[model samples]
Target: MASVALSGKVAVVTGSGGGIGRAVAIAMAEAGASVVINDVGASLHGEGASGSPANETKALIEATGGRAAINTDSVAEWDGAQKIVQCALDNFSRIDIVVNNAGILRDSIFHKMDPNDWRAVIDVHLHGTFNVSRAAAEHFRRQESGAYVHMTSGSGLAGMVGQANYSAAKLGITALSKVIALDMGRYNVRSNCIAPIAWSRMTSSIPEDSPEKKALVEKLKRMTPDKNAPLAVYLASDAARHVNAQIFGVRLHEIYLMGQSRMLRSVHRSEGWTPESIAEHAMPALQGSFMSVQSSSQLIPWDPI
Candidate 1:
């Protein structure tokens, strides 16, 4: 089989200290793209910062004879985001691909969630994606070509208990990527989202002794290890130029494209319809429409460009 290569391209991956981000950065580098790896080196809750993770990933890439640089900027601020992208421009001269994979979790049920928790998660996930993508989009438009991959979560699509804040922010990322893809198509910029189920530091906290935990672990084990980054690497390559504004659920040896359909039905009005009469007639339709609006389905047989 022929391999997908990204020679002559410059790529940036955020939060690449470890886990999926690390895998993606290394895969891009191996594919011949000079990579800029960014990580705040914080904990799962976005607390604290260190340079160890970023430096370690960079060293590993270089050791493997790949081109890479370390960036230690938090994506929560505009200036920080700008510097992260600037690292790519300064080192590689231009950026052709970006994977907004930096994220943190502030999990809590809606009632118990504090305002600070909600705001913090939103800042890092939703606003962080905006800051980085906006800076990259400008350069992308100038170059007339670029690819973006935004990291979302299955929780955002299916919803999970005690993760109201995290889920909301992730869902916002999906929406943002879709809108960017729609608006930037004319500029030859393609933006897509990925919801991945992987075993990372973030998921290690779940106990493995329980039956539910064992089942979840088995499911995740079925997902390819960090080596299964080609799926994301492909999305960040010229090969996927035609794919835009879509979401994919990535696992080891499996790729599932997420399909969305319209939730609203067309409305027709009759002549001389009064407000009261229309309200009376619409009650049953309104109730019936609930099912369609709430309905969501997972795509079978994963495929990507």
Candidate 2:
């Protein structure tokens, strides 16, 4: 089979300064795409900024003879996102792919969580995604071709304690990607989401010197951002033009497609039923399919593979 190539293509990868975003940016460039590496160089908690990370990533790409430029704009802001897209047009002329990989973590127990924490995470993960995607949509629609690869998470797909804010935002991105896929399909635009389990500063929250944490780190070492990058690159390639509106998961060597929400089973009644009748009839039918109330970790209790 012939290898997938991105020659003559241009891509924009938000949060490309480090981790999975950096790996994806480099991979896209290696695949022959001119890339816009956008990153404000914010810390994991979305605090502080530095230009070094974006500069280093740009340098790395250039060192390998890959065409790339850096944009230190916040994707959370509408104007900043427009500038990021404009940077791509200014340098590469046209954009063929957009990878929304930038996000911040603000984990806290739901009841005890601060409103500011919730808003901060939502603004970055959800609003930032909208800002960039909306900016690119106009160009993609005019060109009649584009691909969107968004970063989602297991925290949203499954469930994670102390991550209500992050989980909600991640899940919102998944839905947004799906809607974009539906709306842009006719224009040859594809949008898909990936819930990846790879180590980054975000996962550094796992305390050191614990057995579970040690196991997770070992597994993550093998996983790497590189392992996850190929999938993003593939989604952006011409080969995956037919693949859209899907949720995928990458864990170590495992790559799986996730099933979205759907009715598992249904029951019908000859006539309208009261609350008592619903309890008597519907409860029994749905009981067998009911998942446990506990979160993913509480149910499985295993380290990342």
Which candidate ranks first by TM-score, i.e. highest?
2
Query: What is the lDDT of every predicted structure here?
Result: 0.83, 0.89
lDDT of 1: 0.83
Find the 10 residues in a row with the least total lDDT in model 1: 292-301
Q: Write the per-residue lDDT of candidate 1 for residues 140-230, one digit (tens) a residue.
A: 9988999999989877876676778878888889999989998999999999998887778766665688896687666665554374477
What TM-score does candidate 2 get on C-alpha atoms? 0.95
TM-score: model 1 vs. ground truth: 0.87
Candidate 2: tens digits of C-alpha lDDT, residues 1-305: 64578999999999999999999999999999999999898899999999899889899999999999989999989999999999999998999999999988888888999999999999989999999999999999999999999999888887888999988999999999999998999999999999887778777676658887687667666767878899998999999988999999888777889889898898888997789988999889889998776754454355455
Model 1: how far is 171 from its true place, Å? 1.1
Compute each candidate's TM-score over C-alphas: 0.87, 0.95
User: How far is 217's C-alpha from truth in model 2 (Å)?
Assistant: 3.5
